[model samples]
Target: MKKVVLTTSLLAIAAAAQAQSSVTLYGRIDNGIQYENGSPQGHKIAAESGDWGCSWFGMQGSEDIGGGTAVIFQLEGQLNTQNGTSSGALFGRHATVGLTNENYGTFKLGNLGAGELQQDSWALDPQLMQRYAISTLTHGRNWPGIANGFEYTSPKWFGLTLKGQYDLSNNTNWNSGVLPAGQGRSDAIEAIYATGPLEVRVIYDELRSTQGNFNNLYAASRSIMGGGTYTLGPVKLWAGYQHLNAPQASDASVFGTDAVSAANLPGGVSAPTSADHEWGGAAWQVTPAATITGAVYHTNVNHGNGNATMYTLAATYNLSKRTFLYTEAAYLHNSSTSNIDLGNDSWGPNNYNGANNTTSGAGANNPDYGHSMTGVFAGIMTAF
Candidate 1:
């Protein structure tokens, strides 16, 4: 009898300890077919992934460690559902370990996302940063991942919370340059305020290139964004503005020595120093499971780089709690000197920078300068 009682006590203790820890695996898969016109190579049709949203799998867990604090960890990776390939590394999306407390807040270390810059901007973006939304105009500068990062998120006080992140280049030269592991040293800070039906956020972030310079207007630059959303019944309104600057990108050298040519450069200038981007839109929940959204995004690039505007409409219908069908249509108009395309970070065949004078059908992903482009997409997404 004594032996049995002792064994039972040990089993109960083990069970109690196990109850203090928990883990969860979650992910989303999105795949779709896309059709577009106006690339230098002409119209094309293809299957794509992560157009409406990124397809990724991840596991997050936490352990209660007494004193109103807990240890938390997350490992996430993005994959192209169409090709079964990962984005960069095995866990490139996120790999973090942290401690959280209700009173003190959360502190994390390791490879991480752009914190609230990415989190809050999604909510504020009219198109949720989709394939042809905000990221498209700025060449995907708005969404960046960080490695060797340290992050801190403060607890909500009233309706306001604060967060910040710093990524170390992990080199001896402080901000020497982009390393094989990640970009040069970077930092960002954000503030968020949420009330009954409205939320607002502001962020300031910057990334550096070789010799700690902002060499690429879209790749290595500084950006400040402010935006907000208001909820009214079944309709939500979104508006935001962002400014990007890369002072070091003053000449054709940033693009490359062979990048400059008569096709792209009219006066031998092939670099953009600054840009202003703005967008606004609204979403309406027509029914319990359907939503319709419309938005406009515009960008004005300086240095004769011209400007572009995009108008888009999208809809989503939920088939179940974890699955949905989505469709969207968009049109992008580029100025006489600009070659912005319809897809995110799409710079076209000239991908070199400046405008391309090529009218030939080639291996280009976007249209020629001064041309217009249109696109349509349909896809299905599921989360688990």
Candidate 2:
């Protein structure tokens, strides 16, 4: 009888412990067919993954330790669902451990998500920062993952909250120049306010080059972003503006410009020293499970690099709470000296077969300089 009573007591204790700890496995997969025209290689159709969103899986867990505190951790990675391929590195998306308290707020360290700028901008992007939206013109600058990162979040007070994030170089020389290409220290600060049907956010961030300078406007630079949203019943509106500057690249760099023909000076193209980007759009919930959005994005490059504009329309129909079908159509117009691609930035010379031209390295989808581009995509996405 004593043994039987002891066994029952042990089971009770185990059940109580289980109730205090929880874990969840979650993921999403997206795939689609895409069509585009305007590249020098001609029009083409292709199967694509991560066009509308990324395909990734993750596990998150938390244990309540009492006193309004908890220990938490997350592990996440990305994969190409179309071909069953991994996106390199296990847990490339996130590998983080943190702590949270009701009064002290939350803290995390490790490979966190993108910096505060990207996180804060998501709330104001009408297209949800899809492949063919805000990121297209900026060359995916807003979508990079953070490594060796530390982050902190403040508790909401009077509908206002704040966040800060820092990404370390992990090198002996702090923010060291000459470490390697694309290796630099970065940091950002963000503020957000939400009340009733209105929300707004502002973020400031900067990335240093391998030379410890803002040498590449599109790659290593400083940025200021301000945006917000307003919701009225079934409709929501979004608008934002961003300023980017790279004073160190007043001359030319590898990502700068080169002669497109013998008539022009060789290796004499000047890179953009500053730029202004703006976007605005609205989303309408036409039905309980259907949404449609339209938005315009524009970029003005300094130093006569010219400007470009993109117009896009997207629609989604939900078959279930966890599954949806989506489609988008877009058109991009580039000025005589500008060459911006649709969907994703090529991040290289815009001209075709120009001096030291390396558009092939980026992809064959880059259009010729002073040209236009059009694209359409249809895809299905599901979350589990």
lDDT of 2 by residue, 281-356 (tens): 9999999999999999999987767789999999999999999999999999988766667756524444321212
lDDT of 1: 0.82
Q: Which parts of model 2 are misplaced by more than 4 Å?
A: 177-182, 250-252, 255-269, 346-363
**Model 2 lDDT on a 0 to 1 scale:** 0.78
Q: How close is candidate 2 to the true structure, as a TM-score?
A: 0.92
TM-score of model 1 vs. true structure: 0.94
After superposition, which runs of candidate 1 have C-alpha atoms over 4 Å from their true positions?
Answer: 114-119, 179-181, 260-263, 346-363
Report the C-alpha lDDT of model 1 over 1-384, residue by residue, as the tens digit: 999999999999899879988899999999999999987777889999999999999999999999999999999988999999997788888899999999999999998863425545787797887897778888777887778888999999999999998888878987855622388888899999999989999988888875787877887788899999999999999999999988987554364554434345655345787999999999999999999999999999888888899999999999999999999899999887777777665223245345353643332655676789999999999999
Task: Go through the candidates in order and give the clash count of each.
Answer: 1, 0
RMSD of each: 2.2, 3.0
Top lDDT hit = 1
